[model samples]
Target: MMKALRAALLGMALAIGLPSGSQAQTLRVGMAAQDVGRLDPHFATSTIDRVAVGWMFNGLVRFPPGSIDPAAIEPDLAERWESGADGRTWTFFLRRGVQFHGGFGELTADDVVFSLRKSAAAATSAFSADFRAFESVEAVDPYTVRIVLRENVPSLLGILTNYSGGYIVSKRAVEQKGEGFARAPVGTGPFALQGVTPNQSAELVAHAGYFRGKPQIAGISYRFIPSDASRDLAFQNKELDLNYGRADQTWATRVRALPGVTVDVFEPAELAMLHLNITQAPFNDIRVRQAMAHAVNRAELSRWRGPDVSRPGQSLVPRGYLGFTAENGLPGHDVAKAKALLAEAGYPNGLTIKVIHTQLPEMLNMMQVVQQQLRRAGITLDLQVVEHATFHQQIRQDLSPLVYYSAARFPVADIYLSQFFHGRSIVKTPTAVTNFSHCNQADAQIDAARVSTDPAAQLKLWAEAQRTLVKEVCAVPLVETLLVFARRDTLDYGYKLVGSMGLGPQITEQSRLR
Candidate 1:
């Protein structure tokens, strides 16, 4: 059965960048899911898609390759960039030798301009909102691109990094291939897409023409197995070099005990937050919101959430991020105070709210703990579970009064505040976007910080907005969980795995089998 499955997996892509029947110097990987969303970086929402494209794309700037700190931005496609004295105009000096795959032609200012415009179009990009500050972007010369902003923005570099809206695509490739560009993507990264076989698997080969030079491994085969047990079995059988790991402590410990396995744990993982539809009735009342805020005991919650993998971060903004200044005043376990607030809000009998969430193990475990906590405060929670994709879809349509979500974004406070709390992004409104709470409380301060050229002033404004979000309970920040992964000890990842910006640990050109 295993042999038949292997044959089916590589049936078509066996000749990729290798003579037919060659071993391919292959590195096989097991993912936590069956497939990725859109392979287009601009619209890719799931981590599977993000990691897939990260191998084929190059952003103008990157987060200092291998470093987990979001603020550590460095040049990628551009050799260096300079800002005008007024701080409104920025010019990027492109690296001359970069080339797109499949002879799409040398990357130039034209491609950069095209990519920026593409990302800014609301019709094309999920990240169009990030480009709101752009006044103009033009190819000044063959290797020079200029960007003019309406105002000086502090998070400009953050937005231009791979984690944000910085990926640059081949204009020629996109124009010629049209919709097909996403399936067989073309970029200037260290690897090129060899083949894709839907939910089963995908193959990528090292790009010898890669400006960064040839990768250590000749090829990679990514196998999609939504079943965690199947993935674990494959890893034990040596069919995969790496496997996506469960966040549960028991699973992590079991993996760590394997003789030839290596386990990596990193911090500042996805923030688990509960968003209340503030546009709705009871939540519309600040007293009721406060009651809900005081209902959670983060310490007890962590035990249910796998203590070794979770920590109570006191701000909507996670720790290790800029403007992380509020750890003192966040609401905590106080059932008596919560009950008093509910009484004052004319709900002495307490209230019931329905929450819609993904059916993943972590989400289920966390919500169950939350259910018990809120019940103590006389708040009844009725949970509706759905598939991961449908949960995101339902919440965006405002179908639930409460929503629990886990997400990671560029560590900039302004971007978080703007996208998640700004009036312009309130869900169900005409401008409905990611603002699930339909909140406008932080709009003024968030906008003020966005345009501030002075870093200190910008940080202060961003900090103020976060404190406000916590106090108002628009979305109660819960815990920042740890990310874990297990890989064969024989494979050596050249760079230190301090942390990762994507769903899984990175497999770069430097990664190789010993």
Candidate 2:
């Protein structure tokens, strides 16, 4: 069915004078990031870089929209899979005739094992946490692979959908190409790297022999324009076919009104929050956390940001997650309640706090708004905005008492829960990404959810854990972000907010550009 759909789309594109062959025209895309460092899927973290690497790689399993059953894992290189009755062991059946781009030979189970093990190997990878649950990965035969888990992990398959975690790389290509392979990766996807201009832009050409089928348009290029306004200008000048991150709704409205341009909104499974350091003096008390939560005006902030663009966040788990509910949610604004809590926490006269943040123009605006809101509740906030790089370092070092941060992921409850609250994560470093009120008992509960096999049981446990964290005033939820994509009307595309931004290549056949 997919092949037939691809053929029909290709025929349609050809009829409209768009390129149908490998040397077809390049579809230019613009983004807010400056560069994509490595095209290697295993090492890449940023969404901008991941989208580029995604084109040049294939995973054993592909996630199609709206499907969660492991048995229904869509095929890329693997044709099918089966699990033992105990659910600890999983076997994958590889496709017989697929070959990697750039003249690598057929992919086999050994390559699968090598790729995963390399990701787990500390010397070779930065994504070790992604595969920490797997006890062993082995090749059962030339075309079959088996994975043994330390325990039953029902979310293992769902976790594999992450670009950093699940993408499969060719062992032959890596061994033959060595370190340079990251820049010039070879995969079985529709697009292959044509050229890269460091931090500026990258070009990709469709691989005619792509296993699924070739993309309708011939090639695609990503132009890095870090400034949102600059990206909008590029789109207006016909230099870009699509723009990924547009925060200004006013500019989005203007762009949509222009000729040959259209705007699409994607409701992301992402969270934007104000992370408070619970280990710090002022925030150590639960009353202090509750006071801050009640002091802020979420509804006003959401309105100021834009409608249908930002909804007041209720929990660390966004609204779309399986276990999110009002009962397990954060406390809303109540100035009197906030003042009372503040007094009880020994700050009756109110105390001043410092908010360390990056100096992005939009971010500064947000911080100013939050600062003013806190002042209205008789709480004084000192703003300490700095450069992006410096701010990130401070957060990672836990030197910052409060900071604004955002995370995008597939709508998996575990992704948010495990990454933020899991006890063993380096991201949960003392002053860093710790999601708990202070990373205490909450960490154990989150870990249990990750390794649990039963879905219903996991949901119940996670829900209870979330309720505890919210009641204890761990992290202050701000809003659930809605991603906006703007493009020239001549370009036709369908985007679903899966993870961050851009379309996943598994569904690229649905994309059309004239």
Candidate 3:
């Protein structure tokens, strides 16, 4: 029965020339990896899925055309916004005449309130924590909504701009359909969800009455090709209009040489780190953690890929982050110091530790190189490579003592710090589901910074918290990632590298070849 259904869907997709069924001008996007499961905007935590949801939904506020900075919030559904002097109350004036797709009619303040409240509701979202700071959301009139907060949140606006926090759904639609509404979301965005095939692809069509104006492109067909090689091949064959995420530098160069292909490189606000489980024996001692940090030769790691690939990561926050400086003062490699620390930790003869790596070829290579460097300092590492999903599960369960992982963040330091180091963050699980390094003080400082309002004061607090985490060796910083997008050069689209993920508003604004 399932096979028959899939065949029918594929037949439909082929018959229409694509799932969107619009040949007038359809943009077909290729992704380097498959989405990490759910398509519901509120449940999307990974960059891969966020790109897809970015097209299917509209938030109260959005990042401007070329800017990914959360600080530069722009009007989306809401036309104007203001906050009280205390910064505890925020008021947003919704734009009238905006209507949801599928004949839902007009948008109002109540819909705004419903969307925001629903995202914060415990039963509906995994990211409720992002909005937990809010005290209440109320509709003042048909076109005005007011939000009251328990305290002054300096990053409240930034949080609201997050993909997970901003994707607004129709109140009436959700109420009518309940849980199934996520699969068929109704919004005031340029595109309307048309169909979805679990683990396959999702299709959307241009909404004729989009508030900004109808997109020049008739529709979008988002294909879910998990393999980077497959995506590259598709682009080479002119089967896709755009591709997201990085690819092999060599392959990227070749694609760039192709006629009509455009390759863009941008610095991503994400870092790949080697996180240690502090609850375990070897890493429990600060001396042992410091030894691991000092043993790594960051120069060699930086050179693993070409200059365009990565930058040496110096702090928890990436280099371009606000308040980041070279002199924030974190310890660096010193072979002698590493040896002395190892001896002090009662491992004078060195110790053998297991290093878990995800299935990504690049990450696995990185781990192997790290293993070689650690061996030079008398520390032996046993490499264990697993599928990405399994690796994440093991880490969340605290089943792995050491794991290679990456954390993506916006241009701000507050949300990044809170989600990783805060005691209550999902990343810091407590049971078999716990990934906490068991660094209690680090968690406390992160929590404190969340409520801090002064930018200067907040930076100082965050710097201290990061330094504390580094000094304790909770996570060893490796490299700040770069955004690498490969295309067939024939497509003309604009992309920006402003945030952690290097996607832009081009998906909603660009025209495609007929």
Candidate 4:
């Protein structure tokens, strides 16, 4: 009876657009997700999971709240750090009097060592591929941590910044709760995870003992509203102070016109790519893969997605990323040439291939656009649409012949190339990452770029790798879609929204509703 009454009241609130007094004290956010996959920072890859974990965890160092530049990284849990002359060994001095949430005790080098080691272990972390250079991590003392790399890297600080596989977790909490830590994580950030209500919401309270300062907002309510209409309706009704906005000009213009609403079309564009499985039958031929490439029209797709929110992707590495180059060795679109190539590959009438795709609105719509474009070139796509989570699982298991995936990484060429195109990251392998295309031709260039000391040398090697990948037709780079979000103008995040590696606005201790 009470549940029905609450629903009735919520419906009435939606109709009347009632403003809640309690909501002013707590920032309510609506995300397009059914639920968070994992709260554990090590395994949180989805936008919803990454956003929640970003608030609850801190790294030794961090990029400024709204930035992803490696040069802008500043001290967080670690006050200072020094690298050895060879750049192989580094030491970090921990901040004193830092407390972990949920009574996990004070932050120390022990927790840092544990968290980093866990991050490097392939058995424990999803991002273990990025830590291939780590030789060892140790606690020099309770307040000092030392890391030894096997070789010099382009930017050691880039890997240590607060992001995927770099977030520090409470050692004691993880050991005490074991696998239960995913449900209730402990960190030394400004916010603490309170609890999670399945398929509904996750609540986080401000950490009183945060090293920086106490958070201005009392708490955060992360509500899961999967439908675009429902999320927008909730925001219109004032139930949501901020919500994930659609990445389209129509949606942005519409939302910006709403009273007190501000739309943010931020940086770190996620590159949408079409990875053709070379191990599969039809795509095994280089001619077929080339045909697939020629069939994709980046401009048409970008126009369909919206020019303000997206741009034509031209390189393997995303634009604005370090070492990105537009000299990718790929030909321009030629439908006639594509059909000729198909005929030469013994598919005179073209071929049909089954593709497992996600039902997520943004991705689904992008695939549909690609589908129509491919149809013009006489290529038929048998799209098998499934739930978002199921799509991820199936694709990882190598069930999809053509995989349309989108991602925004640490804004480095090495991270993108090593994860998406390197042989070690090939699916169904011992060191499996996201190398869905099984492209190993550019492995040497990618590896060389990682250890190259000179900036010019590193960029050259990265450029060479991208050229090789494009020539191989391993994956067709599509539109680079920027992130979009909407918030009430009165809510202050205390930092300018530029580029967030976490893919959301980083709410900090100073964020508040005025």
TM-score of each: 0.90, 0.83, 0.85, 0.94
Off by over 4 Å in 3: 1-23, 34-36, 103-105, 121-123, 173-184, 245-249, 335-340, 343-357, 360-372, 375-394, 426-435, 443-448, 494-506
Q: What is the lDDT, from 0 to 100, of the residue 91 in candidate 2?
A: 87
Clashing pairs in 1: none
**What overall lDDT goes with each candidate model?**
0.78, 0.69, 0.69, 0.87
Give lDDT for model 3.
Answer: 0.69
lDDT of 2 by residue, 1-514 (tens): 4244345444544553456554344577886666666677766644566768766777777655323334555766778888899788888898987777767877888888988898776446646655677899999899999999888764566545535657777889889889988788877776777667766778776666677666666667777776877887788888787777555567567777989776766645347677676778788887888888998888887888777567777887888776565677678889999999988989889989877777655566767887888887778888787755466556656666776776665456666766565555434453233343345557667777777777887888788878877776667877666666777765654444333322322225445576
Which wins on lDDT, candidate 1 or candidate 3?
1
Error of 1 at 10 (Å): 8.3
* Candidate 1, 104-130: lDDT as tens digits: 889999999999998887666767778
Candidate 4 TM-score to native: 0.94
Off by over 4 Å in 4: 1-24
Ordering by lDDT: 4, 1, 3, 2
Candidate 3: tens digits of C-alpha lDDT, residues 297-352: 77677766556667788886677776454554567888789889999999889999
Q: C-alpha displacement of 150 in model 3, angstroms? A: 1.6
Cα deviation at 7, candidate 3, in Å, is 15
Residue 245 of candidate 4: its Cα lDDT?
Answer: 83
Model 2 clashing residue pairs (backbone): 260-489, 398-431
**Preferred candidate (lDDT higher): 3 or 4:** 4
Most lDDT-accurate candidate: 4
